[model samples]
Each structure stands twice: as structure tokens, then as C-alpha cells.
Target chain A: MTVTLASLSQQTGLAVLDHLERSASIPVVHGLQAQGDLIVIPLPVIASSVKVWPDSHWKDVPGEGVELLRGAAGGNPHTLVADPGTCRWTTHVLDSDQLAIGVFETSAVAYLLHPEHGATGCPPGTYVIRRQREHEGQRARLVAD
Target chain B: MRREAAEIREEWLGRALSTLPADRPAAEAAISGLYHLIGLAPPRFHWVSSPVTALTTVPPGIRTRPSETADRVSAWPLPSQFSSLMRQLCLALDAQVRWGHQSMDRLIRQKVRSPLALSTEGSLRMPLLAAHDSRHRFQSTWYDTQCVSWIAHYDALRRAAGVLFTPEQNRQLDLWAAVARSGGWWWPREGACVISERPVTMRTEVCGDDGEVRLHSADSPAVRYADGWDVHAWHGTRVPSWVITDPSVQRIGREANVEVRRCAIEHIGWASYIDQAGLRLVASAPDPGNPGSELRLYDMRRETRVLLAVNGSVERDGQRRRYGLTVPGFLDDPIAAAGWTYGLSAEQYSLLLRRT
Candidate 1:
């Protein structure tokens, strides 16, 4: 079955903007992809910087979806959406720079839905999700766009 | 039970951030009831337009205490006495909860009480306190007691969690709820009580999973009062008005705070600021996942260079937003700098498939 913004919005009961192409099937990518301030990369790509803990706790991504990050001002979240039992997320991954929010493993295609940025599909694999940051004078501040 | 607690939390949160005019009569009656519990006569009512005004001026009939004055609203003992009264009521209510209900009680504290407390602190108390003094010298029990988060927690216990309360305890809770819903912060004294009116306008952004909010506005004051007292914020970080109104390259250069400088630079788009500041471009390359978009790197400060990138998706107005990310000055390659942001190597980022 083809997955579009309309179908994801309907599946999660979330509203998407009219400006987005509602009917076009979303593409599934197997490589590094970014959405707004978050970047999703395959686990092996950043193995030096990210490590999964031995006692990592993982939770299944429910049918409703799991919210990853909520954008500032607009307050819309980047939700990781997939069929139940197909994916799980763990926040116990260690990042050298402390940027990783979690690691997600999906047996099937996983969709990340957002209101303004539309939706992007992630093919089955283990991926690390990290937030963007900018250098301040002497500090590093997380980017919240 | 969590859902029910959330509903109760929303109801109280609405009242906490309310900009509505005060209900004078209801406030006075509930306040009188509270005074009656403390063995004092109903104090005369003193109303002020803002918390700052309440701090700067004393009520007409009362002499002042140094601790209770302007920025030192912390040292007052009366509010602590009221806090004790509340503490006793909570201890009584604690007895009514059973073993099974204890977990529900903890969940209520997490889902409703703690988040509400955080929201109250961020949205109301912090801004008002900063307005008077930035050091935050005064104790917060005075304001913390007045915050409806705790009251709402108890309310959830009784109404939603089905915990029983003594008739007298319920009566006191009702009085506290009435005073809270009636108006803003209040100060109880020996023979008088002072109350402040809510802000005339407040703008906030949702900042947390549990419905927390913080003040934020781009061009206007995030919070304003009937008087002219107002606060300007940039995405929840309090900032000077110039950062919003007149963000110039010179002003940004002179600004000592790096966060403020970033906010100001961002107020003007990164691309525009780079152009206006006349920073030399180090390198530019096509963004792999974004198809037509380009990633340009520019010299920003002594040890930092900014990478200007275009949004992967078009906005509602048919324009793509340009954003800047500050990276270490060492990296000369735009793709390498972008990879450093996510802890990836230059080669790892080149395989980017899509961005949207």
C-alpha cells in the first residue's frame, strides 16, 4: 500500500497543512536524511560517537505513534510513525557529544510525520536520532527550529 | 486516572495564565475565609495593576517591613504561615489515600502537579521576579504557595482519583480554589490583603510534553500589563527590546551576550546578516539531500564560523527559510562542517538521500 501524508495524518489523527502534497506517496530512504532540526542516520555511520548501553530500555512504537521532538513557536512534533510491533526506540544510547535523543530499530518502513515539514520515510534499519546544535561564545546551544 | 488528572491540570492552567479581569467580590470573600482561619479580621483590599506595582508601593493603611519590600518579597513570614496551613491540609489528605491509590497519587504528582508547578514558575513568577531583580535573591515559597498547581493536584485526588476528604479539609480546599480562580497573586497581612491583577496580554510557546509554556515573541513584548510594564523574549529567552525591534550588525557585534547576539542575528536572517556584516565566504557546496539548496560557510567570530543552510521544504508562503548554525572555525568544507554537527564524518554525510 502507498503511504501519503493524508494516510499518515489519518492514521495518527494529526492535522497536516494544506500546502503539502497530500496524495503523493512518501519516499522511503535507506541513507542519512534530515527533517528540520533533527537528523536520522544509520547506526554504523556514527558508531564512534554513539554507543548503545547494555541495559538499554526499549519501548515499542505504538499504533498511535511516538513523538520525538516538538518544534519551537509552532509547537508541532516530529512523530515516528509505523505499524505496531514493527519498531522500537531506546533512549539509552550514549553519544560522545550528547546530541543523540534515541536509537530506533524498525523491521519495516517507518514514517516521521510533521505538520509544516511534511513527512519522510525511513527504511528498515537501526538509526540514531540526534538534534542539531550551534556554537555560542563558549557554549553549545541546541537548535530548536 | 492520568487523563482525568490532565483534564484537571488544563482547567487550572487556564486560570493560572488567565488575562481576565479580576473578580473582586469572589476574591475578597475567599480571602476573608482564609483570614478567618488564621485568627485575623478581614483585611482591607488593596488592588494593583501589576506585581511590580505591588512591590514598589505599600498598601495605604499598613507600615512596611524591610523583608516584604520591593525586590525582597522573600523574607515575609505570613506567606510561610499560610504554607504551613496548606501543609497540614495535605498531610490530612495523605491519610485518605490507600496503598493502591498511592501509585495513582505519584502519577498525579508527575502528570499534573510537577508540570503545572514548572509552567507556573516559567510563565509567571520568573519574569516578574526578573523585572525587579535579576539575581533572584528572594525566596519563592510566597509565589509557590499561591500557584494553583498544588491545589489542582489535590483537586485531582478528590475529583478524579476518588480519594475522600474530610468535610473541613474540602471546605478549606474550596476556599483556596476560589481565591486562586478569582484573581492573581495575593499577599496576606495582619489587617489587610494585597492582590495583583493579571497581565493584560501574554504570549507563550509550548515548551514541554506535559503542557508547559514559556514567554516568547519576535516583534512584540511577550508579556504586558495594564500599566506599561512588559517583557520581551526571543523563543523563551528574555531579551532586550532592541533585539526584536532593531537588530543591526553593529548592535549584534557590540552585544556582549552570545545567546542574545545569536538571537538578534537570527532575527535578521542568517543569510542577510552574513551579507550585511560583510563576512567572507569560505566555501559553498550543493546540499546532497536537498537537491537544489546550497550549504554556504562564512566566518562569524574569532573561533566560530557559521554555516548557512536553506530549509529542505518550502514554507506556506512559497519561501524556504534560511538558518545559520555556528560551527568550529577549523572545518573548511561545508559538508564536513554539516557532518560535524551530527557527529558524522564528511564521507558519511555525502550519501544523504532526502531532506523534508
Candidate 2:
């Protein structure tokens, strides 16, 4: 399926709902996750939530949170998602070889990966799992079957 | 014949002696003429015997001392021979004068044309030249009597031959001899002898800002500083004005003061420094009372002076030179300021600053 801002925004909204259900605290939506070469979420949702969070805290959360989620996802059977103001992830596999991941702020999935298993050689790729929106909204996700 | 000549000589001598003091001027003239026959001044005589004693004794014979009894005796003959010779020559010239056949010049030339030998003891002999020039010969050579007398007195023969004492010469000789015998003579031949123990005095005067002048008597306890060198401030404070110890620095300081004063009525900065090359003296015109300070650089060996700079480059005589390595801080000490004021050696600059 084609990755799109609308799909990413839907995924981010679901990620925020999961976080709120788990903690029962409103997750402060700072900004959309920015992955390399993609605007993960549609722009309208990220812009709309930016108003609710303090500028300082909001600026720090999205960039740092995306990095944590990417780390949690690891490399196998991982699902990554972002909304306009939230990011989420889950992973279930590990190898003797470790993987390196980086998260960046963007309107897309905002994740980057290399396939050399953290060694000397690998091909690199980036993808958007969600899109930011001008208002608070759900995020989209990508799943490896 | 010989007896008759002898008798004539004796008669002449007697006449000459009678004409002496009694006709004092003529006698003096006659004595002067005799001295001319010789080539020297008349002999000064010393009396071996006191005149008073010699006159009072009234000896029957010529009162001669036995050779063995006398303490000393002159090798030359008695003064009588000199007297006899002068008298004979004078008598001859006198006759020539009476005859009026020849000029006085002719008379003297005829008498003194031959050189005479003056003998002293057995050793010294001097040749007496005739005073008269034969080329100028004239009649009645008796007019040359003056020359005859002078030569005769100076002739070595007469000096070697004791001088005859007139009573006056005898008295002077007697006094001198007594003084010499008593060992009481102390006459220096030339120059005076003085004894003094006073120390030399040097005074220094310094003008203060308050218009009061402080005078330092250098004589008391002088603060002497070496030029081109630095002494501690404590040492300098004792003196009236700072004494520059280094000759080179001292010279530059003196020149700088004079030059600065002449630049204008404004306050002028003067300074000196030394380096490998030589001394440098620099002056700048500034406000009066707040005159800019001077800087100097001196080369000790070459004794040269050059201007230097301080905080900024200083233009001296239309040229700008950088001050020494240490700047802004160097300005604090007068010596340092002086040094920095002009790019100068540390020693030279410091010395000048001390003076300020």
C-alpha cells in the first residue's frame, strides 16, 4: 500500500489512544516524528496539537520520543507509527547481531535503518509510517508480516 | 823697565780705588765697563771675614791667611789682578780720549781685539770675545769704555778671581754667610707651598611643584648614582635631585631637559633608553604641568640615543618608532615609563624614570 499523510495521521491518533489507555494520562503531543526523506503525518494535525503543549516541552518530546520508540522496535517483527503529536512502536524479535536505528522529526514515519546488522557493510533505507496533521489526530502504522 | 810698568799699574789701581764710592756714579760706570770686557754678569761675593773685624784688626802686613790655617782657599788669584787689568785698560782708554786722535771705538777695538782667557781654579777656562765690532771702527775708541767695563766683569777670569768687596758688598756677604752658617735658610727657588684640608663641595637644587625649592648640600652625604644603571629608590630619595649614575644616561637626561624646555611653553615629555646600539633621547610637546613624559634608548658601547614609544606609537621629529616589548604596564614606574616613553633599554629607561 502507498504511504500517505492521511494514513500516517490516522496511525498517530491510534498511537496516542494506546498511550492514553496504558497510562490514563494525556500524552503531551509535542510535534510529529520527522524521519529522513518523509513527512510522516499530514501537516494539519501536528500544527493543531503544537498549540496545546508548552513550546519548550513540546520541542523536546517529539524528537526524543521518536528515538525511544525506534530503539524499542529493534529490527525484527517491529511496528512503527506516528501521529501529528505522538509516536509509538512494538518489537518481538532479536538476533545475535544488533541493529542501529535513528529517529528524526518529520511529517512521515521518521525512522531510518541500515541492514549490515551494526557491522561494516549495509544498505540504508527510510520510511514514513504516519503523517502529521494541523490538529490533534490519529497516526498510521507500518507492519512487517 | 818692568818695575816702571808695575809702578804705573799700581798707581792706576790706586787712582781707580780712590775714584770709587767717593765718585759713586763714575765708580759704578767704571765697574759696569769692566764687566763688559767679560761675557758674564759681575760675581756676587761672600765675605769669609766680617767687615767690622777685618777693619778693626788693622794688620801690619797685607793680612794674608796661611794656606794651612784657612778652611778653604780659591784656586784663582786675589781680586787685585782683575782690578789691575781693568785699571790699566781704563787708563789706556783715558789717554786715548785725551789725545783725541782716535775715536773711542778704535781705542776699545785696539785693547780688546784679541780673545782673553778667563781661568777658574786649574780646570775651567772660558774665551772672552771682544765687544766692539771692528767693522764699525772709529777714532777715539775710548767711547767704548762702557763695553770694556761690562765685558771685564763678566769674563770668567774675574769670576774665578774673587770679586773685590766694596764695604757694602762685604756687609751683604757677611750677613748671608752668617745665615748659612747658622743653618737657618729656607728659600724655595720658585712657587709657593700651601697646606689645605677642605673637602670639595657640590650643591644640588631641585624645584618642587609647590614652588618651594629644595637645596641639597652634596657635601654632607651625597647620593651618587651611576649613569646607565639603576639604584633602589630608597637610595635616591636621600639626595636632593636624583643623581644619574650612568654617564650616558646623565648626558641624555641633561640634553633632554634642555631640549624639552626649548620646544615650547607646553609641558614636554623627555625620556631616554639604552640598547645594543646606543642612547636615544626623545621629546614630545604636551600640555604644561601635564607635560608628556619622555623615553630614551641608549646603546652603552656606541653611546647613541634613539626615541621610543609607549602605549601608542610616538611621532618624534616626524618619525614613529615602537616602544619596548612591555608596554602599558611599563608606564607605571617612572623609570619604566621613561623607558617605554621612548623605546630604550630597560636600564636607561629606568634610570630616567627615577629622576622624574
Candidate 3:
């Protein structure tokens, strides 16, 4: 049974749902958060959740996948998690050190050994981060020349 | 200075009368010629300018006959009235002359002041005294030159009056006498008089002699008279004429052409109103103090002199209307060309000339 991280998160706490949904794939959830009016979801969950999530949520979600979602959600201290395949969980990753703990979870299917590996599997709704990287590169090149 | 001018004017009047023509025809010709020169139609003549032609050594062909003469003449019953008019004219002329002299004197005094440096305050200082001097100079020049023409006119009138009438036919003198007694030919009394045949916008007020003031529209029938020395004022784009009892009260009602002395307690005098006719008439008197104080005729056409008791009442169908006022149409006569030309600045004269 394939279930979106958003559906699992709605049924359970964000931490427990994330652990289940990211068992084998990145899970993305798009909707309002419990803390404020802002929208929050895991970056990797977009690709896994897009087909299952409601059409309204999919429309308002950013187009460049999970990297963009992380960029918007990154600065604040709050953590989030995602799974790219199978049963997805929308969960929080509390810190950079805690990202390793996901390998021990019962539903874990793959473990990203490096942050770069997570970047390579980035899901949808993360275009803003890519654009920001491209803009910085252009500015750096012009200054150098 | 005005009194001096008046004395000189009286002497000139006597000289002018002595120069009159003895022959009726010559007298009539000369008088008619003078009238034409001054822009008036020939007046009716009796024994002096017509039948009395044989009494003087004037040629019969030289006389200009009147278009028509009344079969009878009215008696000269208003002697004091006539004399008063003459006195007013003399007084006006005297005032004009005195004003010119005084203005010149003022200019000279101003010129004697030391010139000041152009500091910030100095730069801001007004040049009023200099302007006044220039104005006075202009007046003095005009008066000195044009006064002769005025004297000539007076002379001509005196001689014509002497030669144009016989003792028996001199009743016409009563008309002139009445005009004089009423304060010259164009003098309007100091009060309100019905002046126009048309309705107009008007404002009226009761101004106390002690300085109390009130105002209203002319359409209102009830108006409180100003107390003794108090003045009832009225003015507007169009004003209905009414009677004024006291000359002083009328003077107080005037609101224009007033000048204050430097002392802040003396007004120079009131401005005169010269109607389209050659009549120089008094319009108002200035307050003793207050330089800016003046009486203005909102409707010049509607302001008229109030005939006094001395001039008698208006008569209608052999019935006497007591305490009446008269407005002389002679000023409005088609041939009359009266106006103020002397004692004005170039700009002022231009304005007057344009209006005329």
C-alpha cells in the first residue's frame, strides 16, 4: 500500500510518520504547519507524495522539488524528513548529527552517507534553492572576470 | 492759501464784470462765443443781450440769438441761496489752490532730508515721502499753468451775466441764485436722495457721531437716524437716492479719497466729485482724525445734492412741495464738457481722460 507522507503525518505525529514514510523513499508533505501560518514539508517527500497529495496542495507547492523546500524551511531551527519511495513518512531531522539515526529506523530502505547524496536525489518543489545557487555562481563569475 | 486765492478770485470777478459789453448784440455774441468755447448751448437773453443792443456800441449782426426764450421770467427770490453757491465755488477753488501750494511745500521739505545708506533696514525703508514730493510737484506745475484757464472761464461767466440781462428781465438770476445757495450748481447734499430711475443694489448703515456703526439694505424702509454727530451710511453697486439733512453728517458718510495727516489726528479733507458736467462739487468731508477714513459713493450716478430750506421746495402743478431736493440736468446737457484736468498726476489725469 503506497501512502503519501502527508496522509501519514495527518494520522500520526510528524516524527513517527516521517520514520514510516521514508522507509524506502523520499516523502514530501505540503500544507500548513502546527506552529504558524507558514507551509512546511520535508524536501524529499515531493516526488513520493505528488501523486497521492490533494491537487490544491500540489498546485501551490514550489516547482523545483525538495531542495527549494529545504531552502525555505532550512534557516529556522525546525527539522523535517522525507522518503522518496514506498510508504512515506513526513518527519523532522532535528540536527545534522541526527540525520545518521534514520539508518537505524525499522522502515529505513537507504541511508544517505553524505549531504551531497541527499542533493542528488532531491525531489520536486525545490526550484528556489537551485535558482539561488545559479544566481550566486553568475555573480561570482562576473566579479572574477 | 485758499483764502488768499479766494480774495484774488473776487477781485478778478469784479474786473471781469467791468469788462462787459454795453451793447446787447455785442454782449450776446461774446457771451454765446464764451459758452460755445466752454461747450454749452446758448442761453436765453432779455433786454441786455437782445433789445438793449442799442445801449452799447456793439454791431447788431454780432449777436447770437437764443433758439427760444420764455415769454415771462421768474422773480429773483433766492438771493442768500445764490450767494451761498457762489461762496462754495470760491471756497472750492480756494481749497484747490491752497492744496497745490501746501503739496509743493511738503515736497520741498521732504527733499531737504538727508539721503540714507542702503543697509538691510534702510533698503526696506519706504520711499513714501519721495513719492509724495513728486506728486506735489506735478500738482503745483499743473495748477500754476491751468489755473489761468479756469480764471478766464470765471471771467467770461461774470461778464456774460452782467451783459445778458436787464433789471426787469433778471428773474433768471433766481435760478442761478438757487443753485448757488444749494452749494454751487452741482452740489449734492450730505444725505441720501433718490438718484436713479432704476433699482440697484444698495447698503445702508447708521454710524454714530460717537463712532457707533450699523448697516442694512436700502430695501428696508425702517432706518434709524444717526444721533447728533452720528452718520447713517449707505453704499452699493447701485444705491437709491435719499435726503441728507446735515452737511456734516453727509461728510461723515463718505468713505473714499480720504487722507490722514502725519500726526495721526488730522484728516486733510474730502475729495470732490466732478460729474460729467463741468461742475466741481463737494462729495464729503474727512474725519478730523484717521487718515484712512473716507466716504465712497458706491453708485456715483445715483448720488445727488439735497436741496436745503434756503433753496425753497419743489413746486408741482402750482403746489409747493416743502423741503425738496433738486438735481441739475445742466451737467447732463448734451453740449456740456466739464471735467477735472488740473492738479492730477500723469497717471491720474490719464485715467480721468480715459473715463471722460
Candidate 4:
């Protein structure tokens, strides 16, 4: 299935969805996995994201809430992504719903994987696009019966 | 486009392999070993709040005044281990640049002028070219590879930290970042090494009072400055006051007169010349309003103007007359006559020998 950031932003509410169509001299999207019609690339996948996450401990994030998205932006609230460089593997497993909308055509994906293009590595074939509740926050404490 | 560490390592080793005549396996293994060691500790980032003190409006030449208020500034410290890794990596990088120079000389001798060199030997001393060049080829390539790898990593780190600076901060930060990029080659001499475990911002520590030892009024002796006699001095907060005074005189009817008391002291903002009796003679004070904090003293002559060094050193200039003193008849040696100066220790008398 094919996807673009415009469609992803409708579902995810992230502005980074808008940049998916822009072309870069270096391929930002190394590879992609499908979740029905959705295309998901890993969060903080770029070398530049190393700055946003900085340390190994920040690799794991909690939920796909607005608060989480804002924090990931590193004070840039308008977007959900920092400037992307070449791709690298991340231990972080972000939900497909949380990922910004984007798709790389087969040729584009091939360009990224090409040795000359200097893509770090390709993402795995399948993605675990688990769906969670829209508002995954703590419930009010129940009164004792 | 940023290349992965592996891709960079591969390209480098491939080039090295091509350059080397033999030992391909060993060269490859050595390159891999270096890669593993460097990869073991990748640079990491941290968000931290550090104490910062800001100072404004510093007087020129004087150290800036340190502020009293405490400020919390956000800063990122490179991982502690990275500092050691950086030093090691820098030494290796410097070695690479050195090998490049070495190879150029060898290439000229072995390839360009080999025939000429053979003719000069005259069958007496035959020079055999060693196979060491092949090994150096691998090492040279490996070092170059590591340099590229390190540069990429450092560039990434800088990019990651790029947002920390605003436009104004960036202009200054870029200057420092440039220094930091070349910083891998900077190594201190063998005796002293001060390594910082964490990244730190530059700071100036200004004190309200210049740290100079004040002399008690009683320690100063009275002195008279003669006209055409020059008093040179260096003065500042940090300077220690030492006055080296030499008095010269022409023969009088009975006693030697104080003709010229030439003295040079450390120029602080203010300095003066006094007679040996600890009396105020001539004062040269720099204008406090002048930002230069000028450390210069002018010639002074007069008994009333007192020469005071807040914390300064005074020294005798070379022109102090050597022949004016009369030698005792008992001291027969001409060397002693030339060396002897009244009121000086043997050590001081020896120092006067250079004048002769």
C-alpha cells in the first residue's frame, strides 16, 4: 500500500506529515513497512535524532499522546520530527498511529538501500502496528466499596 | 548524506588493502580492531543545568570582575569516557598526518631518485630498501580512515548540539567549534596533562582587588631621583614588588655624591622612586580611568614624590656605573676591584661580574 504525510497527519496530527513529499539529496526513508494503508518509519531514526534523544536511556518512550509527541519535538511544537539525516536502527518501538505520515516508492526505497547512497541499513520487513486507546492515561482512583 | 560507520570503515580498508603489497589479512584485522574499540564508546548527550556567573562591563587590561549572583545555565557534557577516547583518537590522527609526510620523502628517494642514489654509493655502501613501506601503507590508510570516521562522529555531535546556540551564540560557537574540530591534534608536552572529563564553557574569573602584596610604610626607604635619570617600572595587580636600585656618582672633594639613582620596577598603575632612606621621592600613577590599565612608568626626580609599589618588583638597569667605587688598598686583586661593590653580598657582587 502507498501513503504520504498528508494522509498520515490526518490520522496522527503531526506537522512532519507535510514534509514527506519533499525530496532530499540524501534518502531519508531507507525502507518502509505496511500497516494496511499506512507506511511507518521508526521514530528518531535519523542521525540528527541522536541529538533529540542524545543518550541511550531515552530510546524507549511511553505512549502516542500529544504530550509525548511534543516532548519528542524538543521544544519545536509545530513538528513531531527533528531534522532527519541518514537512517540508523533504534531500539524504540513506536506505534504506527504515532508515526508521521510518509511513504517511499519502490524506486525511492531502492535508492536508499543502494550502497552508493550510503544508507545505514534497511528496516525489517514487518512492523508491529499495535493499536491502543486514543487517550491512554491513568483513570481516576476508584472509591472503596 | 552521512555514511554509516561500517561503510566508512570498509572504504578505508579497501583503499589500504590496495596500497599494501602484502599482509592483507593482518591489515584488515587491525582496522577492525580499531573500529571495535572506537565503537565501544559512542558519544552521548545529556541535558544538564550548570551554575553560571555572568559579568558585564569589564575595564580594559584588567581581568573582568566575577559576578556574585548564581545563574543556572543549561549545558551538555560529553560523556566522561569520550574525553579519553578523543585524546587517543587525536594522537592516532596526528600519526596519520605524520605518515603522509614520511611517505612523500620515501617516495621521492625510492622512486624518483633511486638511480642517482645508486651511483653515489660507489660500490662501498649498498642501501637495501626495506619492506616496511608496505606495512606503513596499511597503517597510513588505517589512520586516514579513523580520521574520517572521527570527523563524521564529531560533526554529528556538533549538529546535534547545534540547536543549543542562537544566531549570535552560533557566531561565537562556530569559532570555538572550529577549534574543537581541529582539537584532536592538540597534545600537551610530556610533563603536564590537564584533562577535563566533561565539556565546560569558557569563563573568566575577575577579582575586585588585584592580588598584590602590599608593602608596609616602614619597609620603604627614602631615595632621591636625579634629573636625566630614568626610572622604568612594570605595575599591575598580579605583579610582585621588587625594586632594583643602583646609584652612580662622580668623584667629589671628599664623599661620593648621589649623582643618578637609576631604578626599574614592575609597572603597576602607580609606581615611584624614593631614596634608600625609605622616604617618598617621585610618584608615577597611571590614570585609573584609562581602560588600558597601562603598565608604564615615566622618569621621576625629586625627593618629595614618594615611590611606592602596591605589589611590584624593582630591578637595576644595566647602565649602573661599574668603576665609580674606590677599592680598598688591602684588596689588591684587580678582579676584586672590578667586582667589589659596597653594601652587596658576595652573590650580588658576582652578578655584577657580567657587567665587566
How well does each candidate reproduce the native contacts, as fnat?
Answer: 0.75, 0.00, 0.00, 0.00
A34-106, model 3: which lDDT tens digit per residue? Answer: 1110112233322232222232122211111121222111121112333433222222222221111111111
- List TM-score per model, in order: 0.91, 0.12, 0.13, 0.17
For model 2, residues A45-130, the per-residue Cα lDDT tens digits are 32322222122122322332232222111221122333345332222212111111222233433322111111010012221123
Candidate 4 regions off by >4 Å? A1-145, B1-79, B98-265, B268-271, B275-356
Candidate 4 global lDDT: 0.23
Among all windows of 10 consecutive residues in model 3 chain B, the one with the lowest summed lDDT is B190-199
> Number of clashing residue pairs in every model?
0, 115, 54, 37
Candidate 2 chain B worst ten-residue window by lDDT: B121-130
Q: Lowest lDDT 10-mer window, candidate 4 chain B?
A: B122-131
- Judged by DockQ cut-offs, the docking class of candidate 3 is incorrect
How far does residue B216 in candidate 1 sit from its true spot (Å)?
A: 2.5
Summarize candidate 2's per-residue lDDT along B1-356 as a digit string, tens digits. Answer: 22332233223222211211122233333333333333335322221122122222323323344441111212113223333454564454333333332443333222222111101100000000111112222231222221222242222111222324345333332332222222110111011101111112212232221111122332232211112111111111221123322223434345433222112111112232334224333333221111263433332222222224332112324333333321232133434433222223345323221110
i-RMS, each model, one decimal: 1.7, 40.5, 49.0, 39.8
lDDT of 3 by residue, B30-136 (tens): 43433343345654443322111211222333331242111110111122232343445545433433433555333222221111111101111111112122223
Q: What is the C-alpha RMSD of each candidate to the true structure, in Å?
A: 2.6, 52.4, 44.3, 36.5
Task: Kindly report which residue stretches of model 1 are placed more than 4 angstroms away from their true locations once superposed.
Answer: B1-6, B66-72, B100-107, B135-138
Q: Which candidate is the best by DockQ?
A: 1
Model 4's CAPRI class is incorrect
Residue-level lDDT for B315 in candidate 3: 26
Q: Between candidates 1 and 4, name the one with more favorable lDDT.
A: 1
Question: Of models 1 and 3, which has the larger TM-score?
Answer: 1
